[model samples]
Target: MKITRVYAAVLALTSLLFINCSKGDDDNGGNPPVQETPTIEGTWKVVTNNYFEDSKYFVINEDNTLHIFYEDNLGFKDTQNANYTNNEEELQLTINFGYGSLLANYTVSSDDLVLNFPDGSISLTKETTALAPDNWIKTLKIINEGNAPWTERIDIAWNGSQLVIGNGYEAEAIGLVNPETFALEGTITTSRHAFAVEIENYDDEEKYIFQSDNGSNKFHMYDLADNTHEDESLPLGSWIYGLASIDYQTIWASSNNEDSIYLYDYDSKTIVQTIDLGERSPNGLDYQAGYLYICANGQLYKCDVSDGLEVIESYTLPDYSITGVAYDGSYFWVYAEKNNEGKLVQLDLSI
Candidate 1:
């Protein structure tokens, strides 16, 4: 009887061990842990202290398309489109307004995303709401058009009291233009083609005109008092396209071939800073107040000085190609050829 009772106990213990093993398999072996999918396809916004830069919103779609929207305080809006590709590890963007093809290391959390750029890193947050598109080009209009010298390239600059236009690109003169009527009244014969021109006045006694010839890769200074070329012809080793005065001793020059703008000091004969615009070639340049206006790819861009000279706003026009731009005290002017005739026109910027 004792042997039979021991056998029953052993059989009962084996049955219990089998049941525990099966339950362990069902709980741990048969089922695996679930994982979350990774993604960054959503509308995002960058919050910044700058009033203009803070208004940028980036909308990323699942179809690998990206749209950047900008709106100012006055409700004027603009849009830029580009292609983007994002893996879990990296993000890539095609050509943009200020940057070229860019590859940035990225990290995305539940609602926050950060991208490391070459210059710096930017943080963005996912936005649940999307912005409505209102293109600003629809409101842009030319206020006036007037006769300009027959030249392939035209650059204009505000010379204190009037506008001086350059008949550049193989043409050899700087035409004195009446700002009110936009009429070419007189001309100053130049030894070489004046690709770009800027005027600087320190006092009534100190005034000069700066000129650049395209192939020379150098710029010459002329005293406005005597119209004589000064010995200070600065060479920057790159083709210069545009010139804008920053101060009496400093100026900015743009090289379309190098896609850079150089802040050069004529007195020191040194380059203070070289700003790279990536693939965007700066064709024409003008400085007003604390902002810089640039013409590139037939579009007008306004860059803020407080924000590292980054592009804050852009203006575009249909059926118009801008070769050069200038800002008078009250309005902006551009040199363009419409209907097969080269003309200088005042642009309305109220939008």
Candidate 2:
């Protein structure tokens, strides 16, 4: 009887140990399998093709939202937003532009994302992030040119309530019909070519103009209040092709022949700094916010004028020559000389 009892106790202990071991395995089994949902969430770059040779990029959010950015063959950068979805293998994206919806497809690979469009397919490598969009307000073209058409193009600037325009040879003033309308008000003729125009700092009550001749080594300044031009010039030793005001007292000018930018103090009329922008022919300069924007050889560039005039970013256009550039607080307006058409392009600056 004693032997049987001992055997029974050992059997019961063994059963308990087996039960505990089974429970421990059930509670803490090796990590469960990692299940992946059929979702593509991240940024994607668009492949280069005939229509978009410069390469476009896009971003996809977790909630099915999408943003597409590309530069058209015309050298214009454009951006559009929409929604996207993926079903196991194929991806479908739709962009609604009020006028219509644009549909596109994509096939994802291990290291590549290819966009399949109606025309052809574009393959893009998987990148860490998409490119930022361009910060453009609006583009205003000197369309009518005060009803008097001229052979050469003119640059424009704003001085309080007046609109100032400068041709290579003269500076003209116009009255603002509204914020967008310009009517011929007055004209100031200069002996030298007025390549660029800017409002001088500390002279908000008056207008100071910088005029540069084609081959002249110096740039001249004129005062609208006194109706007199100063003989003093900023000797760049090269042609002053374009001019823009950084602020009320600071001005920046670009030289095509020298391939440099000269920053001058308006009060002292002296050179403060200079920036060499490589070998590109720089022209049509305008300043907005904190950037010095210039159109050179059909491409657009933005540089920081305050510090050392470092190039922050650059973009290319399909066409190679732009006559003039203007910003209406929002978008970058470019006049295509090759096509003889005005293009108001929106740039996406999202990083």
Winner by lDDT: 1
User: Between which residue pairs do clashes occur in model 1?
Assistant: none
Residue-wise lDDT of candidate 2 within 259-347, one digit each (tens)?
A: 77788786687888877765566776777777778777666666666666555666655443454455544455443343553332323
- How high is each candidate's TM-score? 0.62, 0.51
Tens-digit lDDT string for candidate 1 (205-252): 668888878556678888887889885546663667788787788887
* Poorest stretch of ten by lDDT in candidate 1: 131-140
CA displacement after TM-score superposition, residue 152 of candidate 2 (Å): 3.0
lDDT of each: 0.71, 0.58
